[model samples]
Target: MQGSGGPRKTLPELLSELDTMLGLAPVKQRVRAMVAEMDIDRKRRAAGMKTAERSRHLVFTGNPGTAKTTVARLLAQIYRELGVVSSGHVVEAQRSDLVAEFLGQTAPKTRAVCESAIGGILFIDEAYTLTEGDYAAEAVAELLTQMENRRDDLVVIVAGYPKEMDEFMEANPGLRSRFANRVEFPDYSNEELAGIFRIMARGQGYELAEDLETALPQRITRIPRGRGFANGRSARQLLEATITRQSGRLATMGDIAPEALNLLVANDLPAPEDSGVQQGDGGARRSLAELMAELDGMIGLAPVKDQVRTLVAETRVDARRRSAGLKVAARSRHLVFTGNPGTAKTTVARLIAQLFRELGVLSSGHLVETSRPDLIGEYIGTTAPKTRAVIEKAIGGVLFIDEAYTLVGDSPSDYGPEAVAELLVQMENRRDDLLVIAAGYPADMDRFLDANSGLRSRFGATVTFPDYSDEELAGIFEIMARSQNYLLSHDLRQALPAAIAGIDRTVGFANGRSARQLLERTIARQAVRLAAPDVDLDALPDEELQTLHVGDLPVA
Candidate 1:
């Protein structure tokens, strides 16, 4: 053999470089494998074999903040070392950079970028944005031709949302075969995201408070449910937001109190603003504590109550373990509350926040509740930022999304799917400080999970809230009656069982929620009866307002 130089630089070297810079090991290993094959091809050419150069095109599909860009950069270095191209630079572009206004401008503009990235990698971020019009279509065609003409000299990586990536491939048949290597960057699991945040936090020289550290993962798991606006990008945004909030709080305090500076206290994270509540003008703003206290006093839901208590205990144990310098094991904090409308999912979510606080998982244990409409935006690019804003507010607390399945729809223009993808990403990234609980009809929820594998993987534990039994409905009715200070007469109590039993058998009845509605209707009927002129108002004491009889109830 000709003078053997020191053993060839292996693929692991490229992976090690990526791991050092970007903290992405899995992606690095993948790119390393690809690079190793390229190196093999290089040696074959050197030995005078007639093997053709293998194409280095890659397809990157994943939610944002999964470190696709970072890995892309490292791959460029590997390619340069393998002598695939002269310059080892990675040129990053998106639809905005390629598409042009004039009729003939698109091709030249696209080619210019390709030419500039010669002998290196050209990364197209959100490459699906090229699907806007015929001009963009032509631009993509030109891009493919460029790739073919310079196959050995260049590498192109196209990336975007998964569905869009599918569409992009379908739109260009030549591209499908050209991109031989496809790498899907899956959304980081809750535990993975927690680890990422911990790394970032530690690297930044911040000592996460013991209680806050313990509570972060549960908070992260609950973030994606109803909020349409968040995903992995939201997690990064949340971290940045926390940093900003912490900086602001620090600024306000003139003298740096040593204790305050040492501890990442409750005030370091900002409180979430309620979207449902109007601001500026005088309006009712209820505290979560008040809501939890009121809900605790309501009767029934023993199973739900017990489960909530257990969750609280687990959180406390985790917190204590963290405080004691013990490693906490990853467990799913996901919950599925399945009662019919008004069976206390919202109320329970509020209580869950307080439970988080008591267990040292949250600072204030506030609840930020949203629905599908809160997340899905009217346009394409707006969804990501809007969803991120909602998560930012819900940080350090519970982000409850009710009727979450509504975010998954059939239409490309629906924007619901976009919201879902974003939510998945954010859930992965913020798996420490945000808790997301999504509630909806059981069937719809299952379908939603099925639609996105990333979601199925992220929401590991789903607690189903079964419909209330007749007895439980009766208890709910009693709770509603007591709330209005109304006492059921002996006759009404006797009739109540029969009425509740009849309701339980009804086709469309929504468990205990329907029972509460019936009780409210009874209260309204009593009001209407009292308004009648025939009633002897003068003879009846004010306590009569608190009394309800069989006459107040309606026949089923």
Candidate 2:
């Protein structure tokens, strides 16, 4: 955009690049049509003929990672070359970029973003989010006014899911008339994804360890495509993940030659189950073995893991006995998880839902996590309806009610009893498909369960989560650092464990959460030391980029 401070390519050269681009035939056709229409309009104006009014604003509807933003940027450059806009820059903004926290702050924020894109295109990503709240409405209104204010020099493009985009346009009359030009970006096929993967790998100077012509495409196709499926982006993620796995695989070796440095292996490719679903069926359940593996992968939950394994075994045996026409024991699928925050209770609950789905106890492995505010209502008689609505949403899945004790407070007008009554009715009615898990502090959760005899009788099992020790916390910190592409130096490593060991872990002390905060703060401290404003970032050494020394660690 704006020629990027370089010699600009001709329009024919740009068109040729589009022609050679993989997939997007429909998009190419639309671009050609727009070019022809604009060219004719120019010629007609020169001949003193009348012309119809047109809007340069557009809407792009598609799933994630289908190159919508890429195409939009190219279109901005083309528009500048064609004199449709004075500058060919693209300013990208999301809801967070426009909407401010307070009521009066949104208009100025939206206007500033719009003004920045005056001589260019303003690209609003996930534009459907503008219809979410009253504040977002203010942003949308401000955007429309700005679009009209700078109509001569600026264009706007809004991108999101097809259905959501349609609804967004219909929800506002101004949006319908202004953003009339719509282009649909189709999801990339397996062949197209493989093409993108190869281009990305080669651009980064990496070569595949396996045959790209056959094995690569097959591997990509086995990953399931759901509603929010990131088509091209998923392929890129796979390639990056494979590279990370390759690095881990090579780390144990003594040393590697220069030749083997950029080679990605077939074994590094993510397996089909790695995508978290079975291909060919959107609702296919995970296998029991796969769920077990997933549960076992968590960092430090020995007791919870053992309980889940035993439950899985018992459920499978019970199913076998039932199939053989023998008397089978019945167990309540509901549960209670008692632990401090960030102790992996919620994570385990999610895993339990997947396990139950694999065990044929539930139709879907979905988990609806909620809190007291989500269940209880504010008004005189609205609590039951609110509670019922939540239960209805969690039907055919696990309903995870976090901080259940908060529902009951020390007030006579409290609606906790009403919400609880409705929840009990739904739990009994939807017993076949719904599984409820009430999770919170150990003592508070016991009180919550004791509040209703029915809830106490139904949730037959409790899985207690133990807080992580300082040693375990250090391991977590190392994992977090590695995931974020940073390495802890020996000095830093030596300091972190001892610092974490001295942390005050009382009632309010979140185990893994505190460790994560420490890790992030350490990274921030690293940036503070190394990320100077006057430094030439491109000239930084690789070791400097990777290493975090003792100074980065906080003094506990």
Candidate 3:
């Protein structure tokens, strides 16, 4: 294969480069198969046998930063080596590159792009965005015409997310016919990601310390695997951040060794809280490890936490299966969260939304909290729209219906059942992007599911949060007090277990809330003692004012 200038590369040499790419086994296999087909066609033509012309157009589907553009560029050169096209360069484009804002300019704009790549490859990034508007549709039509007229000289490759590319292909019959060849690029594994990081660091004259070489992969594993996770690009970003952090650390020291200038240690990696997963919608960046740490820090939800970890594992495996081009059965993402009040049900639901967003299962990951009132209506024929509005608001995230049982009332004429019916339909239609969580007390949740048989099938998993133990309740009190900048005296801490044990765990007891209420009362008592006439306000140190003694403990 001849280049613009320099030593010519052979067909085998071009293929060797493709094989050397890290962590794209499936993509490499598919490209090799395409090459084999091209070789057979060439031999058939040489033997004077007739062969039908095949479409050279290709579709690349996957999340960003999986090397789709990089592969396309190389594939163009391979096409040139096979005598499929005159040149092997690729013209990269997006919706803005092909579509014109004015009504009359779209065709000319689209044609200009295609003409520029007449002897090369036209690579459209996020090609699905063409179906988004009226002007964009005109560009698509022009593109199709050019693809057909220039089929002998030009190859067009469209790339985007898997689900959206499916829609994009369906948008035009011409697209389905022309782009018959498809290849999926999966996110890199943890090991591949670490290797990418090291490669980038070496290019910039930096080396990872021995401890950091081992710790890098572990750190990558903690990052949430999301649709926006730029597999290779993220590795580059992490390397840049690590370098920045190392520079800051070395600045603090009076003297730095020459060898230390280009070395990065484990401590140079960004903290878990700072290295966040960027959401699909470009919302706030939240770290998966930080969210998991928050969930783990909560008191006494061992079983519930385990269930969440299982969900994370499932999502990760499902992603791998899809990337490998395996047929994955469509599974329900909706869940049933059951427990009494103050068992961290709502808190857990919120965290799960953020977690799913980080895992690429959700787009926005924002939680929309609702109940019966938010769904049901006061007048007839109004319930469906109201319920739908709430579901629409939570399309790319989780819809948490607290006290979900309230949606099914005793009255046959009630609108609650109407809301439930609407919910059932919308949940099915939007299950691809939406996750619905029904939460309430254990018994009430059972009643709610039993009321509607459809609910049970949709909510395959149920995580029951048990009431907190007396010891756990004492821990909760301390956590709450400390959060408010108040300290418990040593004796007060010792008395907390006995005090918590005396509280009755009756219906509607609000297990965690009870601890909070006790803390509030103790703080009030401390305030009264501090204001007494015998106490010297000015002489009292700040520490004494912040501390709560045995006298401040609420009576059992």
Candidate 4:
């Protein structure tokens, strides 16, 4: 709170700002209703009438950059004006500040955070993240205790995506019971977003072109809107970028009038491809020849390579058929990659993501990698939402679930099955927009598929990544060493195959990983030998210093 000496905004002024906000009609309406209810309650109290108790704690649901925080800040001030809280200040925190990474620290951390917000609003952004594990559970428990104890003065606002917030409330019975005031913020419409862009430009003392308003909404409509889309913030970011471009354009001109300097035109705004508002073709553009060349250059996985080529060919053929007005049958894009650790399952998955993007099968070539622990939650009612969150992020590209076999379990109480069930639902719901690649050991993956009939049916194609041979391992080691600017001595090159052969072919032995580890160990040993006291470092040539001798190799 500012001191009495500083000027303050009155309740009407705060409400005016809230009402003038571009979008968020429901949010504005709800806020106005709350203010009206509070005002009537105040009058009733003056008339010696009883007032019903209402929960001031709120749950704000929306995507990113929907003015939730802005509204929260305004609501804090409004609460102070209405004598609901002592201070109009807000203390912002996420899971890290409240939840400890280790044991026993979460309660105190959470309590201290709540104590700081005793007289105002405690705004928790991405509150859904707090339902992850036992540590987060401890934070929620302490938060609930603080909310109950400081009911009079503190207003706790939890904000996140609509779906996750619902799951978060259900995760704890106390949370649903306490946070009764739910306000939803929807994504800004094209017209609302254009208005926001214009307001931002005007606020920065820049003038919009006469035609920009009409052109801006069309541009906004073209941008790919995914789960991570920032409705209001995207417009601001574009305005900033456009301002930079406008300045650049002005710099090249011989002379400019002072008034003309701040004027922006449609051409000043970056094209949709160049603006980076979404993953554009500029980043995802890759020739099929280049991708196939890179795949062929990999040390092994011939079968995997063939399978990938077939998938690409099939996608191309399907696209051509569709273009020619032929009805192409719907085919499953999901896949199961079976292999041991370090067999380049992830590497292949990333290549496939890029390939699919290039072929227009996916919107973005991005790859989201997750494991069993990342999807499954420690508590009940947590797994489905967590899995859906992962799927949401991977909508434009690939969801690569590594060691996916671990998602299958015999325990009835286990959350692994819950994650799998959610994956099946999201996989079907978002099939056209999402590519799911599940990778694990062959035997476990077979069992995983058998555990769920939907999994087996959805992932119709399986690509097998075989363990690299001794020769292939040697080739991989040489390529890695050379790529890092290190050369293998003649003697070391001769001993490489023998060293690779000596490695145990036990279950879960990392094939390519072993080769990488060997290279790293050899480099470390080389560094040690070079740093010997007897060695004159300055006298050695660059080649000698970078070479890997047989003595530098770690024993297999």
Best by TM-score: 4
TM-score of each: 0.59, 0.51, 0.58, 0.61
Candidate 1 lDDT for residue 122: 91
lDDT of 4: 0.84
303: Cα error in model 4, Å = 1.0
Q: lDDT ranking from best to worst?
A: 4, 3, 2, 1
lDDT of 3 by residue, 162-217 (tens): 66777798788888999989997866766788889888899989988987886675
Give the range where candidate 1 is weakest over 10 consecutive residues by summed lDDT: 274-283
lDDT of each: 0.70, 0.79, 0.84, 0.84
How displaced is residue 320 in candidate 1, in Å?
3.3
Minimum summed lDDT over a 10-residue window in model 2 is located at 275-284
What is the overall TM-score of model 3 with all chains considered together? Answer: 0.58
Residues 1-556 of candidate 1 have per-residue lDDT tens digits of 0111223354568656676643345565677677777777878889998766466799997667778887777677767777876667788998877899889999999999998888788999998888787599988999999999888777899997665776677687887888878786755555666576666767677777877676666544433322332345545544555667677778887888676554554444433332111121112335545644655675667677667666766777876787677999896665656556756788778777666544445434567888877786666666765676566566556778898888888776788887788887777665555578888878888887888778877775565666677787888898778877889999999988888888744567776668877998888888888878999867778888789888989766
Query: Order of all candidates by TM-score, from best down to worst?
Result: 4, 1, 3, 2
Candidate 3 versus truth, CA RMSD in Å, comes to 12.9
